[model samples]
Target: MKNLVVAAAVATALSMASMGAHAASPNELAQIREQLEALMQRVDKLEKENTELKTENENLKAADEKLQANDDYLKSEARGLRKEAAQQAVEVGKVKGADWAGKVAITGDMRYRYEMISDETLSSSGVQTADRYRDRIRARLNATVKATDDITVGIGFATAEGNDPRSSNQSLTSVFSRKSLDLDLAYFDWKFATWGNLIGGKMKQPFLKPGQSLFWDNDINPEGLAVNFQGGMFFGTAYNYWLTETSGPETNLTADTMLHGLQIGTRLPIGQNSLMLAAHYYDLSAGQGRAPFYNGSNGNTTDTVVLNGTSTAVLRYDYEVVNLSAEFNTMFGQTPFQVWADVAQNQDADDLDTAWSAGVLLGKASNYRTWELGAFYQVIEKDALFAQLIDSDFANGVSDSEGWVVRAGYAPVRNWLINATYFLNKRNIDAPTSAGQLDIDYDRLQVDFNVKF
Candidate 1:
């Protein structure tokens, strides 16, 4: 570079010297030398500035590459944070779902009934017995909660005596004393699959009884575990009910009364009609004489049969029951009708071990002003079923009873119903008392006003 600049300056000075060789003096030559020197100085200054600019550009490129790498890293971190946030949201939703109280549903019903009862003994026996009249009320409240998609829990409160499982009606007696309100039901139903459910605690009866309430009452909620299954039109249930839980007198005595039950039923459609049929077998374990059937309730007590008139000798008793129920539902024009029957037998009782009931119902009530009429003839023999577990209003909650129940119901509005029922019944069917061939005609009249949510 220095050699090239020196050559250019020498060539320019020679040209100028040749042109002014005969006319120019020493001062002109000196001026040319000074011009050449100034040009060389300017070129050297530009070289230093260009080198500095190139160095600055290289530094800026390195900084730009570092910035690009940082940008990629920041973008990856942002994506990870967004994914983590979504996961946390799902976890929060699951946590909120387990808060059962906020998600529970509440429902209840109230029933007011006026009842009149008369027994033939009250009429005869040279005794003037005024008809018994009573007013009763039943109030029930229930709440259900969802624990998950497949699990649910329910709680219920009802008005009833703590000991009697068959009655929820609080009689209007005791000079306006506070009626007993008890825990009616508390259960968890776990549905692990589409076809089955496992339920625990005190719950609604898991067995299927048809339109006729023969063996089991409507108010009996069994405690312990129950399992149910369904496939197509077929359904079945198995239950292990805890009848008694007690600390017995001895260590080896398992005096607890248990009821093991199995039931199977089917519902099928045939042309324009539907048929429902079910059978149940309940094996009463340890219920022989260990358990009290609603203490002081004679209709459900077991008599101690002394062997050879010896009071010390007693017979072992077991009430094993098997029952079948069937119903036929068909439409007469737009009106619905049903014919149903139920039969039960106790394999252990000495006599009158079989009982049966048949009923006919016309015009099912579903809407406002819709009316229905039904009549049933039921004969519940002694020891056929635990009388305490039978319908409380039928035969006055006594076995060895045969009765005809006629009922009429009307709906004034949705979820509100008015009904009248007449029970023309007979008691002492098997003559448990000393009165042989003696039967008392006991009749009951009931009028109910009910509302439900």
Candidate 2:
């Protein structure tokens, strides 16, 4: 463009020179030439300024594109960072919830009872015992923690009158005296396999007691190591319990007493119904000729032994007991029904070594507004079982008794129930009394209000 402008100017100048060569003087021509030079110089300066402006414009476009690219990148990174932070917050909340709330559990029950007992026991002096009535309360609290996926730890506390392993009832006597509270359960359970558990410490009974059977009292928590297993329809338990720890030598079987037990059972399906049968065998080593009595003998046959110049009644025979139990479960028109039987024998005792019980139950007292009814007849001979470990409420916790127990329960609300139990029993059925042969009538009634959480 600059060259074209200069050429056009030169052509115009030549045309003027050619047109005015005869009519123009030297000064005019010289002035025209000088003016043409000045215009060319001005055109060159303007062209240089236009080139600089184009270069500046290209640089500005490049800088704008670079800034826009940077803005887009920053926006995308910020969005990703915000999403990652939200996910981290959610993960933190889940961990907090599991640690504080999901892994720990607290559970317990409280029961208040009104009990009445009528005894017709006759003493050697021909005196009859009096009837008694009492109000009792039991409160228990337990806490469990899932320390790991396969490990659990539990601890519990309960109210009791004394250190009686069979009962945890605190009588409402002593004019509002401060009652005793003891450690009821403290144990750790480790799931060593998919089908078994290993538990140690003073723990709940690992053996199954079918159909509310009194062969093993519900409140008895044995101390030692227990192994429990279940595979398909088969289940079993083995336990090594410390009964007494004497400082005497191990070879002296008359001092230290230990109880070892094993139970094996199976559940078989039979046409929409199920039947469970189990056999449990336990032996009290070194119990014979030894006084391993807690709260006295409870009517087990005993022989007097002199210890430290004091005569004490020791167990007459070793207790090697085998228990067989069976239960048939069916549904009776939407109500659960069960028929069960339990029998036990002491192989070491030659006389009065058998006990048996049979029962039928209809319905279950579970959930709100549910009810149940059950009855069982049992006869425990003089040496049938270890009396200290049997049911404390049956015939006043004595052997040599035959009785019928009728139980009814109703749940008025969730986790709360009222129960009524009646015992019609005769004691001293086979054992000889202080007098002659005798069968004394004994009766008991208990009404309980229980709640759990």
Candidate 3:
């Protein structure tokens, strides 16, 4: 625009200075003035265009700066997120390292029972003893801690008294007094091999006990070391337990009464059915004569019936038992059914040394509102098995007895069971008590409600 104005001014000055050249024409001056007006208008339009270009350049510069700032902010935020994620990963690893509680588990069960026992016999004067009734309960709590991948330690407590290897029930007495809890089970099980296990302390029966416990009570927890093996269809077990704890009374050095037992079993398939057969042998000959047999409960039984005191012994018998058991299970009309037999013999007894039991269980009470029924007839002769270790409720725990037990169980819901068992038996089939000899009928009724978790 400046150059245009300069050129216009020089032209006007020359036109005026040379006006005499066109002195004959006045129209030239008017035309020159009109040309000057058009130059001024062009200069105004060029100034407006320059101002708009400057404004556009400023806007582009501001936009470029805003974009750069946004990029820097995004980079900073990504760095913060990476740091947070790394911190979270470290915390997760620490939590995994401190997982002691996760490696342990807890389990337990509770059972309440009501028992009615009756002894139908006449005294020497021909009068019967009063019927007995009691309310009993058994409770257990156990914990299993995994110290290593293949080694587990367990400890448990139960409502029990003394060292009654035969029972864990404490009768409700002393007017609902608080019950006592004893160290019922404690053991360490090491599975060092794929087919064998070593367990110590007072633990569960390592040997496979048949449905009918002829020689050992189902509730007995042996205090000893046991090793069990299983390979394919064959399985075996061997263990030794302290039968009597002696503080010393007998002079003989070989009077330690220990129980050494062995068991071996096999399972064979017959068509679609299977049969499990087992043979068991236990030597208790060391506990006879000199050694004392305690009532597992109070350490007393008929054989060791101390005449009003603990010194004199009336009966003593040597026992070495060999028992055989078999179980056959099959489907009976869409439900499982089982038949089992347990027979044990004391090889050292002269007479009444055989004990046998056979039973059948129909259906299964494994689900909600399910039911099952079972019945068994057992004959345990005198001196067959240790009288102290036998079932306490059968034939009043007296040997030389034969009886039948009928039982039924129902499950109203999962994990809950209700059962009823009735034992009809006759006691003292051979030897006569001091009150002469009477084949006394013994009856017991038990109703139990049990829950497990």
Candidate 4:
């Protein structure tokens, strides 16, 4: 019985121990599960924080890129501005350094001419010579200084050198002296709005009209003041001079001393033609003693007049010259045709002292060639004073004078010109010894080559 009771107690103790082990195992498992749940929540919160940090980094990167782009744009604009400024500075420098401004100009002309003459007269002694050829060169230089808008000073120098056919043995010298420097235009031209201009200084005489004529050549320039005005329809002038004298002669006679003249005229345009009318007056008085007779008179007592007199010789010379000129020119059409007529009356002289000319010109001027055919009829009445002064040459001593001219030219390029011309002159002079007049004629042919710059 004791053995059986011990066995039962052992069995009970073993069962209790097993029960306790089972309960502890279950509690440990629950605690483990709870710790695992907390760990999972912590990991989820960390993942959320990581995602927020990644978004913030992306935004910062985008902002940095934008700022870089803005910086690049600003730099580009700055570079362009700097380049433009530099270019402007260079242009300004060029303008400032340019010395050939508004105050400088240069002009000159050179002409080489060959002339052949028939019926040439000897000037030393009254005789007629054979036909001859001559060569001549003429040059002119002009310069100006513009001190102001209204004031200008200028100088002109001209020279001519030639071989005289009459004196071929003599050395070639200056036909006109080399030291001939003239005050071309030393004047102050006042600008006016209503009136044209008022010029004062050594200026051109107002009596003669400007034309390209070699016949009536007058190498005379005077010092005077002039007023020029031109409006819509009216154009006229009143010019008075204190003196009129020849350039080479020094004299105090009425012809060389205080002389006064006036010119009044206007232009009327009819279609493409123009008509000019002018009237002139000159009063001459011998201010000093009578002019000396250096040459002996040829037994002509009636021709001699004593100039030494106290009497106020009211020698009134009046002239009325009319110009009827017309031009028909075109750029591409049938060239040009021009006609002119000049008539003058020296009323103070005899009835035969009248001078008149009528001319007609037809030309075709183009880039390659220019040709003209012209004919003129000139009549100069007999004048005794003119005959005496020119030493009985046909040019001065004339009952009637007539001439005809023809010209042809070619210009292959700018600055160069080639031309040829022919002239025929005829004169009839009244011979005092004979009951009739003497007839004389002359012919000239000229070729010219000219360069201008």
In terms of TM-score, the best-performing candidate is 2
Q: Extract clashing residue pairs from model 1.
A: none
lDDT tens digits by residue: candidate 1, 62-176: 9999999999999999999999999999998888776655678899999999999997654324553467999999999998988788988999999996657888998899899
| Reference-based TM-score, model 4 | 0.57
Best by lDDT: 2
lDDT of 2 by residue, 353-385 (tens): 999999999999988899999999999999999
**Which order, best to worst by lDDT?**
2, 1, 3, 4
Mark the regions of model 2 whose C-alpha exceeds 4 Å error after superposition.
1-94, 248-254, 435-437
Candidate 4's residue-wise lDDT over 77-130, tens digit each? 999999999999999888855643556556777778787778643434555667
Candidate 2: TM-score?
Answer: 0.80
Superposed Cα deviation of residue 1, candidate 4 (Å): 99
lDDT of 3 by residue, 303-405 (tens): 5444334655533556788999998888877877889999998887777888999998887876898999999999888878767677777887767888889
Estimate candidate 3's RMSD in Å.
10.8
In angstroms, the error of model 2 at 286 is 1.3
